[model samples]
Target: MSELYDLTIVGGGPAGLYAAFYAGMRDMKVKLIEGKEVLGGFLHHYAEKTIWDVGGIPPLRCEQLIERLSAQARTFDPTILLGRRVDTLERLERGAYRLRTDDGQSHDTRTILVAVGRGITEMTKLDIRGADRYELTNLHYTVQNPESYRGKRVLISGGGNSAVDWANELVGIAREVIVVHRRPEFGAMERSVARMLEMADVRTPYVLRELHGSGDAIRAVTIGHADDEEEGTGIERIDVDAVVVSHGYTRSYGDLLAWGLEIGQHGVRVSDQTATNLPGIFAAGDCATYANKVKLIAGAFTDAVLAVNSAMRHIDAEAPGMAYVSSHNEKFREMNKRLKRPL
Candidate 1:
């Protein structure tokens, strides 16, 4: 029989990663399962973007934050599973929970923590046929490296924050930037939109109609008025060295929602203590919703601590309500000694 863990964390985003680390401080056996092959969750989509809101941390690229979080998650050597999509959850006869992944592997845990932030997400790709062929070349759904498009004429599609933000970021880097949006009003901060308008060539009420490319690179594109039904009127062709599409993402919770947990508009409903409707089950991160919840990386960390504490109390009613603060905790004595060793 597989060993039953004290806590099993679903999703390896900020919440799950932090829970794994904090659970170690409580001396609980932990396991974390991530659906994707890598950790970091949705942060991988904006790896090159700068993140500044995390408390006590200086501004750093999202990728650097992911690296730090992943490193911290492994501090206690918790069992980490990657590329496993959890398919079902079942309550065992003894009140323990069984989580079965799509690969048919089962994990037994005394308590389950649902931290699948926004569930499994996939970027919304460009709709134009044959657009994918250029993905390997000049077409980009994500900006992994801003330097890649330096000195190139870049065409961006979408009106959301990501689209506008990327356009603004590329203003001084790219030789020229052109933004095409279906709506006249962009769905980004007013100041950012104003900055983009003052820099990039902003085209409103427009949609990418076609791509002109040879081999694996797009050399030009045709854009049309959003309301042009015939696709023949109000057409304009623009030459470009690269194209960026930021259409947002699609999220799927899989069978997780069918497990009878209380579902809210944002996600699985949980109490202030991070306890879910089900016994021995809790939630955290964007996947867990409560009154006045803050939806940011820092907020996810707070949720992780609360959920881990709740899970600890669920496992052993006599256990302390929360782990001792790191500065005063005895669990890190050996770790601190190791850190002090000469390099």
Candidate 2:
């Protein structure tokens, strides 16, 4: 017989991970499935980065926050499946749910939590002329590791926050940091913009027109005006070692809707109590869209608690629907001690 869990939380970001932890607190059998190579979701990309908000927690680095959250999740010891995408979902006659992955793996669970944030998608690639030849080797859409370009000449494209942020991050590390933005004004944070102005190597009002390089590596990039219509004009070339493109991302919802799961624009539409349209199913996190939207990480934690509590109540019919409130001070005391910060 195939083992079945009481709850299956998809998307191991803040939502899914927190949901898994909360489900465990309710003494429910939990399975967490994440589509990424590792846990932490988007926050993983900026691991070393600092975060100001997250309830009572002090300004913590992204990696520290992820580590703390992961530790909390492990307290319950969930059946975690990393680097696996849940491609399909279907309800069975016995009131159970079936989940299928891209690799033909399947699992059965009683309740479902769809927490796939921003859908599962990759960023758009730089399709410059002759750029495809050395894409994998020399060019990248996302900065997987900034340290990889240390002491090397790097050219980054795009005017968005990510592109500018990378330029700021790679300033001291890379040999020369060149940013090519199509518009005269950058679309990043003011602090980043101000910092970028200090680095004169970054070029504005310029667009990357073409890429020229040989096998396995990029040598230089062709730039032109943002107003140029047909091809490149006022074309200037700059030599570089690597090119990183940070245009934007493309969202992919996998096949949740195709597999009979209800998905809304904000994510999975649920009630004030986190109950979804489907019976025995709930959702939380960036993917969930309740009547009132709470997209913050702290909000996801609260929603997960509510959803798991509600799911447990549904499983145990005799259980009362009283609001979950802790009157005791022990919980807060313990939280303070463990987190090393006041609750």
Candidate 3:
């Protein structure tokens, strides 16, 4: 028989991580499961980008924010299972629930917090044949390090926010930056698109037709007008040090969406208190939606706290409505003693 946890959090993103930390304040046995081997959720897609919206924190790299959130999540020493995707959910007697992962392992919990933001997202890969061979070399789906493209000619393919953002970021770094998009209009912010067009070489209504390479490295690429139906007609080949493909992403909720929950176009429908239709189940972050729900990092943290508190009350109706503020909570007494402070 699997040991039952007080709360099981699916997804290790900002909301899930913060929930784990907040659940510790309620003294609940907790477990967190993340589909990817690493935490941070979709943040890993733009790890090099700077995040300025998180409350009370100065501007910092996204990867650093992930590090801090992951650390705070471990304050209670909850069980963390990585690289496991929850595939099924079964409700048992007495409001107990069993969650099975892709690996066939089961976790029994009295309450659940579904925070799997946007489910398991996969980047849209380049459609060109044999393009994957260059992934390990100069072909990139994401810019993990902007410095790596220093003094090099780089070509970015796509019209989304990421594509335009990367082009702007590489302006001073890359010796030459070229952006090729199939549509004349870009999907990124108007200001950002304008900035990118002003700094880099922007080609509209064009698409990458072929990749020329030797061994595993891409040497150059062939691009042509998107409207031209002929394969080789009206094409131009340009030399490049690196090629970045940021088509977009495909989101999959897997069996989770199949579960009997009030799901809407945005995500699972929850109440102001973060309660789902089913008892002992709640949701947070982008995966959960409510009236006037704010879809931001700070909003995710707010949802996490509400979901944690609701989970605690579901377990014990007599429990407090919410945890005391961290400054006033007894749970932080010993933790505060370890911190250095001025006399």
Q: Estimate each model's TM-score.
A: 0.94, 0.81, 0.95
Ranking by TM-score: 3, 1, 2
What is the Cα-based lDDT of residue 166 in candidate 1? Answer: 96
Q: Where does the lowest 10-residue lDDT sum fall in candidate 2?
A: 322-331
Report the Cα RMSD per candidate.
Answer: 1.9, 4.3, 1.7
Which residue pairs clash in candidate 1?
A: none
Top-TM-score structure, candidate number: 3
Residue-pair clashes per candidate, as listed?
Answer: 0, 1, 0
Model 1, 125-216: lDDT tens per residue? 89888888898899999888888889999999999999999999999999999999999999999999999999999998999999999777
User: 60-86, model 3: which lDDT tens digit per residue?
Assistant: 999999999999999999999998999
Please give the range of 10 consecutive residues that has the lowest summed lDDT in model 1: 334-343
Question: Cα deviation of 180 in candidate 1 (Å)?
Answer: 0.9
Q: Write the per-residue lDDT of candidate 2 for residues 137-206, one digit (tens) a residue.
A: 8787767678998999999888888888888989999998988888878888999988987984877788
Global lDDT scores for all candidate models: 0.92, 0.80, 0.93
Off by over 4 Å in 3: 340-343
Error of 3 at 78 (Å): 0.8
